[model samples]
Target: MADAPLKVDFISGAVDYRRRQGGGRGQALPKALGFRKGVTPDVVDATAGLGRDAFLLASLRARVTLIERNETMHRLLAEAMARAAAESPLHGEIIARMTLILGDAREILPSLKPETVLIDPMHPPRGKSALVKAEMRQLRDLVGSDPDCAELMRVALACTSKRVVLKWPRRAALLPGLPAPSHQIVGKSTRYDVFMKLPAPAGHS
Candidate 1:
């Protein structure tokens, strides 16, 4: 028999636990996209799968906009955010900083001029036999493979004013036929490839 479907919850589950234990801006994600030039700029989560990363950004006080193209996933994310909002004052505040939009990020990103555009598009599997994490497996099953990651990367680079952050596998090759990131933040298993949109001109010595 097929294993029972994973429970997709944002509150009072593993997701909640992780958020509560987070290390603020010290974590890789926040560092990759937050505290840039001393600014905790607002973010557009262009591929907001499950919304955990976006929630982390919101908790650290950056306004986050989550865009999910899948109808069912968007509905679930909206419901979870609503539930979190109605829970208490603190949770409500985080939810307040978050806005959920149901649409294609490529189509929607150009309309808004955010300080940063974060693209955490799906990654290809790790290996043949290595077990896929349950959460990621569920996401892959739902959204299928990401054929347009390169295109999305191009779009994000064009849209955001300050920077564009791509959440990618640590060892995976950089997206082909795209401009490389300014630099990367390498964690144990994930990498944040940050592309600066408008880098400052260097000063003369």
Candidate 2:
């Protein structure tokens, strides 16, 4: 018989990620994005290298669409997600909501329609305190730098029906030609650049 799925450890910060977040138990996704209270939004995680962010989103009850291009990384993410689903108490219901896709974000993002599109491309870390984590280093080995991320941004901006939030280092420059974002949420080492879409044409509900 096949081996049982791996066990996921919620403690030790083993399965938690900094970027991808699920709905907090007592907390909810920010209300501005139309996320119903206690209801997770369907998220398209375009760069699912290690699935850390994706897993966090799942933990928060967000229905995540994880996209990865590297064959090996894809396999690892699938295994990890499976392990978490089977072993995590909070994941029983969350797993059903996540969908994994292996391909370029540029190709997958255009085909998906979610309340939000979250992008976390690999950029240079600013300081020693901002160094990449060990897990992220492993992922970097699997998938190199996101050199084509500018193009991916273009595609995401065009395809997202609601908003596109790019997670970037606070010091990093905006994607080429992109204007200042409608909103920005800054953290210690990272910032979420939120671009809201033009409202749907009037008279169309």
Candidate 3:
């Protein structure tokens, strides 16, 4: 029996994001990723779940690299990118600015250079009333909780020259073992913790 083709739809999804809210720094993610007028730093989305955020970043004119470790998710993301490029005019340009990689970010981060690294590891499920979105529930069922998120954060901090942004539930406690974020951008349902790397002191080896 033939397996069903993945039906992930990033084109319409990104359009919805742009149409509903005007995709820009006003959004929590772009704000946390340091998106500024005339400045679109290249970024790596370490946990490129469904590529929603990656697509958003690409639309904002940043070159984005999406990394997904889960084989199933990677396959779906790849198919989604292909479909968007073929079907959506905006996505043609978005696809040009985006790249997809298959591997665990901890292994790949050391080899790449990006201005910002975005990590949105799967956290514990939300309360009963605030049940997770359908897509998120499917992801959770497939990938389970991210147990190595702390290590992933460490690798991102070491490799990234600018900052690392982590998407987390607004009410959940910060991920343990990570230093306090330099600042945060809060949204209605989620918050982004921004950790800016300290500049090396002059004349210091």
Candidate 4:
């Protein structure tokens, strides 16, 4: 069979610098998702986008796999990773721990077993003002709607052995019909809905 094509773009010097900075002064979703202390489980970032969240998870020591369906975003993220690996000492180690996948989460999420699966589908912007970052607006234009978000959530919940966390706008209703989160946290403009899986049976190790 023909090999699946590579999805990410070649890393640019500038963006690579930013990725190594690893969320730097930017607002990171992991912190707001109540994973502030870091995640001990393996994680899959279903909406990888610019990879800020994935980078943060890696920095926090989670073995993270970043999934981006958009070829453009994948390329951009790849370029950023490349830049970081070349310039920053800590960058290479972090990049070593992250796996980048280019595909729909529905197709990918089921095949992997992660301790946690994270979803941060882009919601329609509440405003056309300056508060929304230009890069984010551009990203929305490129990736479009999260129409499959509900389905993606379903697959993630079934496949993950630990938990599935959904990040939503604070005002939006919870995803239809999934078990309510085992817990939740309201951030400045968003909320994290955590769904926990049953624990492993004793001596099943």
Model 4 reaches what TM-score against the true structure?
A: 0.79
Per-residue lDDT value at 160 in model 2: 87
lDDT of 3 by residue, 68-148 (tens): 999999999898888878976777888889899999999999899667999999987767834666666677778789999
Stretch of 10 with least lDDT, candidate 1: 1-10
Residue 197's lDDT in candidate 4 = 84
Q: Which scores higher on TM-score, 2 or 4? A: 2
TM-score-based ranking, best first?
3, 1, 2, 4
Cα lDDT of all candidates, in order? 0.84, 0.70, 0.85, 0.75
Model 1 C-alpha lDDT per residue in residues 82-159, reported as the tens digit of each score: 888998888899889999999988898889877788899888777753477776777788987779989988888877
lDDT by residue for model 2 over 1-205, one digit each (tens)? Answer: 4434333343225555432343443322243233565565677888876666666667666678889898887887677677767865666566677788988889877667556888888876446734565556555555788888888888888888888878888888888878678988776767778888887798985
Candidate 4, 1-205: lDDT as tens digits = 4333333322443344555566432234554333543335678899897776677667666688999998888887888788767856777787877899999989988788766889999885776556886666677778997888998999998888877888888888887877788987677887878887888799884
My TM-score estimates for the predictions, one after another, are: 0.91, 0.79, 0.91, 0.79
Q: What is the lDDT of residue 1 in candidate 3?
A: 43
Q: List residue ranges in candidate 4 displaced over 4 A.
A: 1-39, 128-130, 200-205
Error of 4 at 205 (Å): 12
Candidate 4 clashing pairs, residues 3+ apart or interchain: 8-74, 8-75, 9-75, 11-79
